[model samples]
Target: MKRIYNTLFIVGFISLFMSSCNDWLDVRPSDEIKEEYLFETGNGYRTALNGIYRKLATFDLYGSNLSWGLIDGWGLVYNLDKAPDDGGGRAMKKIATFSFKHSELTPTTDAMWDAAWNIIANCNNLAQQVENEDTLLFYDRTHERDMIFAEAIALRAYMHFDLLRIYAPSLLMNPGERTFIPYVDKYPSYLSDRQTVSYCLQHIIDDLKKAQSILLSVDKSASFSMESRFIQSYNGESRFLGYRGYRMNYYAVTAELARVYLYAQKADEAYAEAKKVIDVVESKKWFAASTSSSGFNKGNMKMMEDIIFSLYSTDLTDWDQKINHLSDNPADEYNEHYLCLGDELVNEFFGSEKSSDWRLIYQLEGKYYDYYYRTLKYNKQKEGTTYSKVNDEMIPMIRMSEVYYIAAEAIYKTDPALAQKYLSSVKKGRGIKNVDYSQVTSEEEFINMIVSDARREFVGEGQTFFMYKRLKKNLLGMEGYSWKEVEAKEENMVLPLPDSESNI
Candidate 1:
């Protein structure tokens, strides 16, 4: 068994950077090498897990497209003022318009697909190693092996969930057999075929539940927060025990479960998971709501305290400067991906509390940028000194406010009053002196309010699109278009699968 495990780990590690699982299986390195050193110690096991996270934060993933670049364009988060053929210099126009099949979009579509699976492949490697790992190998920390194992499971499920959302149709309304994305699990997952929509949802839910059971206990003793998850340097074995916020800590796994359940349209399960996080957040004080305007500042624009789970990308500082662009000059490098908004859209979108909505007043204010509502959510280079390294290079994956949104959306139809209270919590946290849920009287209105808040809260974080996609909400007016709203359809909603996938 030991010899067999060693061979598998060695082969898997060799293909860690390969673009696809199929490529991963085919790698025939000129010289055989062993990664037995990595699994021999508790921290060695940790090294494998942390490597998965580093890959997740790359420019191809959350550090760029998944957060504020390509994904946001699909969410219609930016104003694509230039026409592609007009040769006006901005390529964001084509992406924002969602030219999925366009030749130029192929590299991105392919990269995203490859990047996701590559990271998933890493998860598979760490997962298999940790599951059969000897408890004694984890040294003095009790249940540490389970912690690593559970995070890998949750991360794998989280990746599959996104793949389903991005590559398939929104089955909440248009339930059909036509849409599917693979639910990859095993190492050398080359044979994992695309599954039905419902099939994928069940597996995602099951994986999260499995992770939840292990992490619930693992995280209680660990209780990782944004601050707790770090040290002066990540140089020691003890470093693995900290940084719960960076990993799929208990709350993060729960939050992710809530997100998955909601996507699965299992509102009751979603509500329970989401509400559980909201209830414990204040008591545990692991993660919290931003009670003041400090979070909206340029330095803390990703709102460090409110984050549930995030990626600490080493490349973040430099990466955001180009994408969260502030240049009035068109020729600025990577300016085509620049994200911005008009002043009127900001006010109209947030409703009556627009005056106190810190997102508008502080996060989108012009003091730091060349244009109105230009976001500093990702870019902090100009104000880097003010931002603490504790939260620097961090790209948010989930936040406290999203838990509330999930809870409210999950229960809105069954219990409107309580659902409104959930919305009011996020509103109050956002600097609204008077939280109001009066307008959310009807289900349609309540759903719209949630979508509206998504636009306001998830400006460049690349969340609003999934929210819009899940609910199939029309793109709320803006984007320099006064015409009727664009209806959500498979063509516009589903990101075209790369040829590797569609061809297969």
Candidate 2:
């Protein structure tokens, strides 16, 4: 990944120098060296492909949203936090209200929309450019192009999937009535209309399916590190560019597709997609964590064993932004008062069986001291820091444990015993006692038990809000809010489109 970044820096310098030259007459036609022209060669195509990874690393794109906002932002949908009304936290509050207007969302949301589409546009360009070329022109061109296409297709699908979750209504099982986001198969000459929510999701699924097909053909040996991938200055300042973790490979793509499918509620497809990860985990070859002091940062053991895909920070410092984004937390980064849901809901989820859950208890300090239990998993270190500026954890995008939960869920739909087997697999991985599902008699009882297990397995991992959205239920105190303000509708199951994109 660092090699790719170095190559991109060189490309950027050449482009800058060429642009600065006033005497284009001394050289061949200046346009001959442009992106369009340069990409005509095999190496140029490779560069363009790598450029996709680079683009995803930008702050306005995946670097911020995919791992941060997409996870944290959707946490709002489930009332995970009480988003503050002042400053940066305001937009997230607006999302809770379903009142987002295009003029009100931040530039970040707008930039993210454009960045996502830029990837799609570039991928489309590549697909068009490579169609007529023969396999014999370059080194493993056929294999490379296929892998590139796979990556791009997954990326495009991911972007659209993000949009659908944020904008469209919940997807009903019926294909004919499902809502979707805009679909852009070919680049438009002018603005095009949005597709139905269902259409958009289907297209995303289609793209992912295509990605999975070609990904199966790619080489899998890729290594990554902070030194080479990050743009570090001699004095230690760094521009956070390059692959977030190691370069994304085939396994990551498949895992991501499984997530997309799960959200779409395509149980059968979700199962099949998740099975790919199950196979990997069973082999003990993928998703292991590293054994460093800051293991949560680079060289994470958890990342090696169970993380299917993640974006790495250019440096450990980047975690500061995530920890304190939109808020103020000085010890680490920034902090904010994004409203977490009231205690009633938090406790209800934990239940009276407190002994059975550890995450709910980990925050005993915050709960007993402040009356509100802040997330302990993301707390800042006590090293002379303020309440703001304190992001200091690696946000995981996909974890292998999710695969176990997914398989468990899928298995429950057909065979209870089998579902119990998958659930036990996850428990064993967590070093917990193996649970036997034979003890569960009723279907509803079995589901509730499985969901409880999932809650234990994925606490603060960013899957709660999605489950809330899918179940279409309100947070525990939603009724109280509705009574207190009469008009305070609980928009718990959906996320509004960023007003900026809606207006566009």
lDDT (0 to 1) per candidate: 0.69, 0.51
Candidate 1 structure quality by residue, lDDT tens digits, 104-202: 767776777777877677677888888987788886465898888888888889888888888887776575776466777877554556678899889
Q: Which ten residues in a row have the lowest lDDT in candidate 1?
A: 1-10
- CA RMSD of each candidate after superposition: 5.2, 8.1
* Candidate 2, run of 10 with poorest lDDT: 1-10
Which residue segments of model 2 deviate by more than 4 Å? 1-33, 77-88, 102-108, 131-140, 173-180, 219-248, 288-304, 315-395, 434-446, 449-462, 475-504
Q: Best by lDDT, which number? A: 1
Model 1: residues with Cα > 4 Å off, grouped in runs:
1-37, 82-92, 224-226, 230-235, 295-298, 326-337, 367-371, 381-387, 481-484
| Cα RMSD of predicted structure 2 | 8.1
Number of clashing pairs per prediction, in order: 1, 59
Best by TM-score: 1
The CA lDDT at 342 in model 2 is 42
Residue 69 CA error for candidate 2 (Å)? Answer: 3.2
